[model samples]
Each structure stands twice: as C-alpha cells, then as structure tokens.
Target: MTGTPEQVDYQQLAAEIMERCEVLGRISADPDHLVRVHLTAEHKIAANQVEEWMKRAGLQTWTDAAGNVCGRNEFGRGSAPALLLGSHIDTVPDAGKYDGPLGVLLAIAVAELINNSGSGLDVPLELVAFSDEEGTRFGNGLSGSYALAGAFEPAWWDYTDADGITFRQAAIDYGLDPDKVNEAARRADELVGYLEAHIEQGPLLEDADLALGVVSSIATGTRHTVTITGQAGHAGGTPYDRRHDALVGASELVVGIEQICSTGGTIGTVGRLQVYPGGVNVIPGRVEFSLDLRAETSPQREAALAEIEAAAAEIAGHRGLGWEIEQFYTSHETACAPWLQGAIAAGIRATGQSEAPMIWSRAGHDGMAIDKITDIAMLFIRCAGGISHAPQESVTVEDVALALEAYEEAVRRSAAAAVAR
Candidate 1:
C-alpha cells in the first residue's frame, strides 16, 4: 500500500478491517454477549489494543484522560491544526461488530497507508477512538467527544450506571483522573475539521445498489417518557362506560403516533411500555411508555412531536385519565460542511461511484457532538439488510473495499480543504 491515492490495496485493507473487528469482538464483558460499556475493563482492553495498532501505524498514540485512544500523524508541523478523523469505539449491549469499531479500524488502516507510502498529506491527521459513544454504561452518549470538545458537563460526574457506580468513580477505576478530565478537551483552533467513515446502518445504499454515499445531515430526535394514570378497579366489576383504563388511553396514543408518522419522512416508535401491577385480572391503574420521534430536520420533528402530544392529551382526556410527558433526550439536526461534502463526493467519485447519492443519517453519531467544535462530515458504507446493533449486522467485503479507497481519498481531500482555508 503506497501513499499515492491510486496505490491503495483495497482488498488487503478490507481483510484487515474484518480481522481486527473479529479480534475486538472477542473482548466483551459477557462471554455469551458483546457488551463493552464505558469505562469498563472490557472497554479498556479494547481501547488499549487499538492504541497499540495506532502506534504500529507510525503515529504517536496515547490513551486520553477521557479514556479515548488517540493517535496523531503530526508530520512535524508544530502548532498547525490537524484534521480529526475517527469514530466511537464503544458499543451498545449485544451490538454488532462493525458499528463503532469499524470506523476506528478503518482510520488506523488509512494512517498506516499514509505513513508506509512514504508520502503524507500537507496537514496533520489525528485519529481518535472515542471511549464512550453508546452511553450504555452511564446513559449519556458522546462522553468522549464531549470531553474533547470542552463541553463536558460537571454534573455528569454524579451520573451512575446500572450497578450503582458513579461516572467519576468509573473513570478513576479506568485509570483516568476525573478531576482532570477536562484535559481531554481539544481547543477549537487546534482542529481543522472532522471526518468519520461508518456503516450506513440502513438499507438505502444497498437498496440503491451503491457501495458508498456522503451524508447530507443527521436527523434531529426527541425522546419522551409518558405516563397515563387512571383509577384502578377489578377487571370484572368495572363497567365499560365507568372504566377509566390507562392502558386503553395509552393504546390510543400509540396508534395516533403511528398514524401521524406514517405520512412523512418522520419516524415514531414506542419502544417500551409498562402497565402498573402487570396484573391479568385488574384494570390498569397507570401506564408508562417511551416515545422516540425523529425527522430529517428539527422543525419537522418538533411539529410531529407536537401533533403526537396533542393526540395523547386528547386520548387521555377522552378516557378520563391524567397524562404526563417528560422529554429526557433531544438532539438537533447536524449538517455536514459544504466543502467537506464536496470532498466526500470527490472521494466517492474517485472510487468509481460517479453518481454518489447524498443520504441523511437517521441514527445519531459522534459527528453530532464534534459538530459543536468544528465542521464535520461523514461517509457511509453500505451494510447488509440495514441491520445494526444486533448479531446479524454485516457488510460485504466488496463494500468495505470501496469504502477504504473512498475514505483514503477523502482524507487527502480534507487535508487540501484545510490548507485552502
């Protein structure tokens, strides 16, 4: 693999990525499942393994204060801001092998090519294997990126995991000084821009029969925990007209959410629902459910959410039930920089994908966090069946090959864009 754009060994790169993914896949907390949570021993081992690989690729590597595995190809350019490239290294419980780790491994592969090819880009490249993007351990995603962006909230130190361990304690256990975690923050002026290569985690590219695509924007999402309360009664004694069934009201709201989101690109999901007492012979006294709403843009998502909320109110009122909705998570839509978009498109073209389609990511990514500090862009490679976060998630070697070539080209283009700026 030479440094020249045309000399990349796509097949070899693809094979290496797959091999590395398998190796990391084995370092899970559960022997029966893949669950690498934030700041866990399993996560530490995975991060350290990647750090060694980064060093092997001829870069200065270190585990950041936030537990992120960071590597930099400085090219001896003192104080010149570097182009940031990477993706999360953490995974959701029982997650697929490629979702987060693939991006990091691919980045390292590209760095290896650049260093071994005897040619380097004008601007320096920094690779980051973010420690905690899934938020599986602490329920707060982007922990690593947030630290890097200098936006980490001190209040999160009190955040606890399922095992009753505080985030600060976990950090300390992971060999990171929680008090000095801010040291992980990178100044805005020190980064030219950010780019990430990831699995599309959707079927669009596979549907379009394309190997690669550039992201246009990331979808905005709103999540709510809803509770419908009503009087409880014996299932047999309560008359239909007299009954104020919370479950019924919740069911109506669920139907309303589905009907409202069916017409547009907006999506709604009721992922969790719980009935009070879970009794088979009692009318439900209360019902708690979760609603996840997303759209290509924030306004659209907000509009749909408003409609859903109104429908919920109407259903609760008609059913003689009291309702409460609390929004717990919200993320704004993030658009890729125009220049980086063009650069990614150029990379796609260089990989023989002349008519590269621009797709919007419905799933959240580290780019959503990094966007706060600098311009961000994403390259999505096709995955099989659009399945992710599961054991069945997969990508073809052919697609991986194309992604590698396009990714390498994109780095060169990103470096050039930084120089131009």
Candidate 2:
C-alpha cells in the first residue's frame, strides 16, 4: 500500500471501476434494462453496495439523511474542511450504466489510490454517491445534492412519482425522516470545494480527439409543461377549417418552439406529449407537452423562452384554444470556479496533455445543486459518440484510465491550492 502516483496501476483501477459499474448496473427495477430510481429498493441496494466499497477504500462511510452514500477520509486532520468528490448514483429509465455511477466509482478509486499511496492531503476528502440526480421516479432531480447544499424545498415533499407515491412517503419507506433531511446540509465553511469527474456525455471530447476536458460552465436549463384545450369531436365530423383541435394547436407551437429556439441558438425539445380522448377517430380536446430548453447563458435561454411563449399565445388565439404554461424547474448557468478550473487543467496536463480542452456542459448534474454550497468544477472523460442516458452509451478503458489519472491529479492540485490559500 505504498507507492507514488507514478506507481499506481491506472489500467487495473479503470478495469475495476468498470466492473463495479456493471455490478451496480444489474441492481435495477427492470431486469431487461437498467432502471434504478431514487428511494426504491434498487436504489437502496446500490447505496449499500457503494457504502461497502467506500469502507473498503479506507473511508468512514454512512448514508446521509437524504439517502446519499457518503464516505470521509480525514487523513487524521480532525475537523478540517474537506474537498468533496462525487456524483449521482441514480439512473434514467433504460439508462446506460456509466452516466452517474462511473463518476462515483472513479472518486472511490481515487480515494483508494491516495490511501494506498500512504500520502495524505492537507484537506480531508469526502466522497458522496448522491441518491438522486436523474429524478427518474419523482421528476424532481438533484434532490439529494440539493439537501446537502441546504436548498431542499419543502414543496418537493408533495411531488409524486408515476405510481402516485409522494416523495415524503418514499423517503420514509427509504428509512429517511422527511423532517430531518435538512441534516444533510453541509456548511459552506466546512467544504474546500467540490469536484466531479463525469463522462463528456457529448461528442465534443471525442470529436476533439482528447481523453479529458475541463468544464467551463454548466448550461442554463429550464423546463415547462404546456397545456392546450380545445373542442373534441368525431374526427370525421370535425371539418379542417372549423375544427379547434388542441393537438393541432399544440403541434404548431411545438414547431414554433423548434424554429425560434434554433434561430436563437438555444436547444429545445418537446420530449413528452399527451392527447386527451386519445381515440384515433377523436379530434383531441386537450394536449399537454413538456418543453426542455437550454442555452449557454440566461439571457439566451430567456430570449428563446419568451419567443416560444409568444408563439404559443399566437397559436392558441388563432386556433381558438386555451393555452397555459407552467414552469417546473430551472438551473441557471453555473460557471466553474476559476481557481478550481486551473487545478483541473493542471490535472489534465498531468495526463500528458500539453493543453487541456475546455468545454461547456449542456446536461445538468449534481454540481448544479452543490454549487449552492461551494465552488465546483468538473473533469470530463471522452465517451464514444457523445451519447449517454441510453444503452448505446459507451466509453473506452484507455480514456477512463486517463480520466482516473487526471482526476486524481486534479484532487492533488486542488489540495495544494487550498494549502496555499
């Protein structure tokens, strides 16, 4: 258990990390596909497994009030502020294994390597396997990290899953007290910073032919549910000109959203849609759809949303439909800490990259919530085809090996910077 960073076996570490990801992948609600959700039996099993790994890695491990699996390596520095590392353990429906769990495993791997090296940092290290990030079950993502950042909203307790299970009841079922979730919050003064190593989840790193990259910022994202109401009648009885079909009106708005968002350089998606009186012969009376909008800045995102709203209003008026939009979630653009970005760059450089590529994340992450408590940065590993959240998502062992090296070095650099400060 004594070796320098150079002596560390990254290939072995990467292989083990991947194997562990596969192990976690099998603990899913669906046997045919990976489908782990927060506060479910599958989630509990994964958390327990993660805690076991953390303990074996020489970390004092426990499950937080929010159900986050956490481990701390004080390095004998009693009560010192810690450098936190982790990512979510939850997954989307039919998800790929690595999207969330890879980051957690990598953090644990780094902690093990550091512990085995017999060299400790000035700042203590803590690893968290966040209970929920995808919000696959409740539709309110980042709940675990939000609790840790002291941003947990009581209103969320009322949120229900597809099966009508309230988040509060789910927490109780998961053995967490709904009223004491606040205990998960960590004081800002008690944390040096947060670092997460995640797959690029986009083609940027792979396109650039790089093994790793440093995230500059996470995109501003907002989600809304739009509903349109109109007359429902027999499809054959509804004349094209006289019909006030809600589905047709919503279709116009969806197209408008795509056009406006595209022109404004924003990303927009209408991922969910429901039509009432769903009979093939019926002219839909009501339509509900979800809009997920994202951009590099708030102004850009807002501009696109404004344009979309106008379009929806116009479409509703012209089609004689009633329309309403309710914004459900928003995560503003979060810039990585400059100092931490430098440390991440240094870490990438340590992996034989003369220059570390910088990129922006369009996907939301646990860091968005953690940023409320402390500065945060991310290291991105290249993933094949820039695909994620699906079975097609893939990453190479070589890139993971590089990511492990780079992430560990980033932690070391961050620790050095903390000491200097």
Candidate 3:
C-alpha cells in the first residue's frame, strides 16, 4: 500500500475529486441549482459527507462548534503542530461545483496519498471544510474561518437570513450552541500554516496556458448597502421639475460608482438593487442597492469609496433625496507569507514548470480571515474561461491531475520547511 508522488494515480485521484464535487453539488438547498448556505439543513448534510471523506482519508474527524468540518492526521506525532489545509464548503446560490468543494476534496486526496505512502511527515496534517465563506445567508462571509481564527464578531449573532431567522437561532437549529462558537477558535501557536487550492476564477492562467499558479496576495474587499429615499407620487401626475425620484438618484450614483472606481483603478460592483412602490404608474420613492468594492490596498479602496460617497451626496442633494450608506462587511488585503509562497513555488516546479507563475487574487477567500491566526498561501487551478460562481465553471481533468500533483508536493515541501524551522 506504499505510495509516493510518482506512484500516485493522479488521473484516478482527479476523477474522484471531480466526482466528489459533483456529489456535493447535488446536496444543495435548491433542487434545480447548487445553493448550500451556512448552518442550513443542506450544510449539515454536506458536513457529514465531508466528515465521511475525511475518515476515509485516515484522519480523526470532528465538526467544530462553529460547524466547521475538521479532520487531522497526526501521523503518530501527537501534540505536534500541524499543517492546515482546507477551503470553505458553503457556496453562493447556483454556484459552480468546484469553487469551494474542489479544494476540500483535493486536500483529502493529498492526505490519502500521504497516508498510503507510509512516509510519515515531521508535522501532522489538518483538513477543514469551513461551513461558511460565501455569506450567502447572513451577508457576512467567512464566519467559519473567522471563528477558527478567533475573529468571530459578536454582532453576527443578530444577522438574519432571508427567512428572518437570526444566526443564533439558525445555529441552534443546526445543533450548535451559539454561545460555544468561540470553542472553535484555534490558537496561533498550535499550527504551522494554511494552504488552499482553488480554481483561478479568472482568465489569466488559461490565457497563459498554465495549469496552476501561486497567489501572491488577496485583494481587500468592502461591502455596503446604500439607500436613497424620496417622495412617491403618480409618475404621470408629477412634473419633471417637481419630481425627486429616488431611483434616478440611485442610478446616477451607481454610474458614478463605476466611473470613479474604474478611473481609480479599483473594482466596484452593484450586484443587487431594489426599488419600492412597484407599479408602472408609480414613481420609485425609495431605492436600495449593494456595493461591493475591492482593490489591492486599503488606500486605493478608501480613495475610491470616498469619491463614491461624495458622488452619492451630490446626487442626493441635486435630486432632493435623502441617502444613507452602511458598511456590512470588510476583509483586509493579505499577502502570502514568503516562506509558504516558496513552498508553493517548489510544489509548482515539481509539476514540471521551470518557473512558477505568481498572481494576485481579486476575489476574497477564507484565507483573508485565517491570515489573522497564521500564514496562508493558495494554489490556483485554471478553469475554463475563468468562469466561477456559476454553473458554467469548469476545469479539465488534465489540469486537476496536475493540480493534485502540485498540491501534494506543496504539502510535502511545507512539512519539510516546518521541520527545518
């Protein structure tokens, strides 16, 4: 049963990982689409399934108080500081199969290979399938990782889902004691570092014709809700000069957000919008919308946000409307630790690349939260057309096979680095 990197059947392993992702894909809240939110019935089912996979990988498994599915392979080295590998299992509505599940499945595959190899590592391996990362239910993402990092916010307990169920109530329904969530926190000195493998979710890798790349950093992101209020009146009765249309003001601000952010070299998205008084003859008196802003650094993002705020004020004043903006969530930019980056680079080289390609992630990840407790690094697998967060997301079996090889090598190199330290 002895195995090695070369001895591993990567094609078979890749197939299994993909198939597992599909299996998870089917365990969603929406029957017609993939939508597994945190602390829901579907989440409980997926966590149990992941726990089973972890057991098969020769790891001691448990679900943390925060509902994170966690497993550890001590390799007979009890009390040893472990190397953590993981990704979130919770996904956005109608999410792609590979976005979060692929990383967890790949980590399991690596653990299985390492266990069968009988080449015990200097450090133990820990795998986590985080319960919540998408914030699809609560609008505050990375709750699982934040809990593990000991950064869980007390205010999140009051956050409610669309069904008006508070997070605390949801936790209780999920068989978790909301007051005991802090028990899931892991100390900084208890582990080595964290690593995650994810689809590139962009066109860079596919465009460069590379199977994988190392992430240099993750972008800082901020999300806000903006509301504009005005007087509702009959659309045909209200004169254009007398009208203070909230929707028009909101629209102007949205366009201003795009213009300012684009010119400032930051990214801005108005993903959701709602208008009150829904009627063909009725003018929208109130408008609410979401703004997701991101940039490589805080200063860049702040400057863009400031401009957006000024524009909002101006539009509100000109339209004689009242406007308010409230920030809901934010994650700071995080750099991949140099040493861990080197380990990932070495792993990429093991996959036959003379040089490892480095890219910065514009998307958010659990690593942004985990970075508060430990160093973090990520390996990106190229997806077809760089599409993700949708059913169209895809990755070739050949690419996943190479990713498995790279990810396993990364773990080995990380273990070696830990020993040397």
**lDDT by residue (tens digit), candidate 1, 41-85:** 898889889999999889898888898899998877766899999
**Candidate 3 lDDT tens digits, 150-263:** 999989999999999999999999999989999999999888999999998899998998999999999998999999999899999999999999999999999999899888
Each model's lDDT comes to: 0.90, 0.92, 0.92
Any runs in candidate 2 off by more than 4 Å, and if so which? Answer: 1-3
Determine which window of 10 residues in candidate 1 has minimal summed lDDT.
1-10
Give the per-residue lDDT digits (tens) of candidate 2, residues 294-358.
99999999989888889888998988999998998888999999899999999899889887988
> How much lDDT does candidate 2 score?
0.92
Error of 1 at 157 (Å): 1.1
The residue pairs in collision within model 3 are: none
What candidate 3 gets wrong by more than 4 Å, as runs, is none
How many Å off is the CA of 326 in candidate 1? 1.0
Model 3 accuracy (lDDT, Cα): 0.92
After superposition, candidate 1 runs with Cα above 4 Å error: 1-7
Error of 1 at 80 (Å): 0.9
